[model samples]
Target: MTLNNDYFKARLEELREELLAELAVAGPHPESGHGYSTHPADHGTDAFEQTAGIAVRRNAERLLYEVERALTRIEENRYGICRDCGQLIDRARLKVIPYARYCLDCANKHSKG
Candidate 1:
């Protein structure tokens, strides 16, 4: 069955917006040693905060990349085709994961690999 391009395009737009919002929430990491000093306690807290912020930003960046990839697929007219098996991805699965690159069988095999 041919996939509905409009529906997937709408979903991709929504996901792009959501991921951008999340990245905004993560925000840019503050400069290291801005308020930190050589004092042990102060140094520890500053280090912890910096590490946490970096981690969150990294995750946000990854999500943003995935969202962008989905948008690219939409533009390429390849959005709903499974990359691994060259088959139409199930609509229900697309509803759940608009950026999915594999259909159920291929996805299952990939997970096992």
Candidate 2:
């Protein structure tokens, strides 16, 4: 079956924008810092907040990277094709993941490896 390039492109673009916004919101702010508070509880809270912010930013960055790659593949006329095996990816999978770079079989193989 032929791939619906336009639909996937739009979806990937939307996902890219969302990830960018998430990254921006999760980034460090001037007020989000551990001030000169000597209280142990306050220090722990500050540490936990910083750690959580870092994790959120990291996850957003990773997803953004994948979304960008998908966009690039679309531009190159390579969307919906498995990178590992060069086979056409399932349309159902594309509908669900819009940014998939491999077919289910190849993805599973890579995951096992």
- Highest-scoring model, lDDT: 2
TM-score to native of every candidate shown: 0.72, 0.78
Tens digits of per-residue lDDT, candidate 1, 1-113, equal 45487887787788778767765654433444443343335343556776775676677678678768877988888888899889999999988887888999999999999
Each model's lDDT: 0.74, 0.80
Worst 10 residues of 2 by lDDT: 35-44
lDDT of 2: 0.80
Alpha carbon lDDT at 45, candidate 1? 53
Instruction: Report the lDDT of model 2 for residue 68.
Output: 92
In model 1, the Cα lDDT at residue 91 comes to: 91
Total clashes for model 1: 0
- Which candidate ranks first by TM-score, i.e. highest? 2
TM-score of 2: 0.78
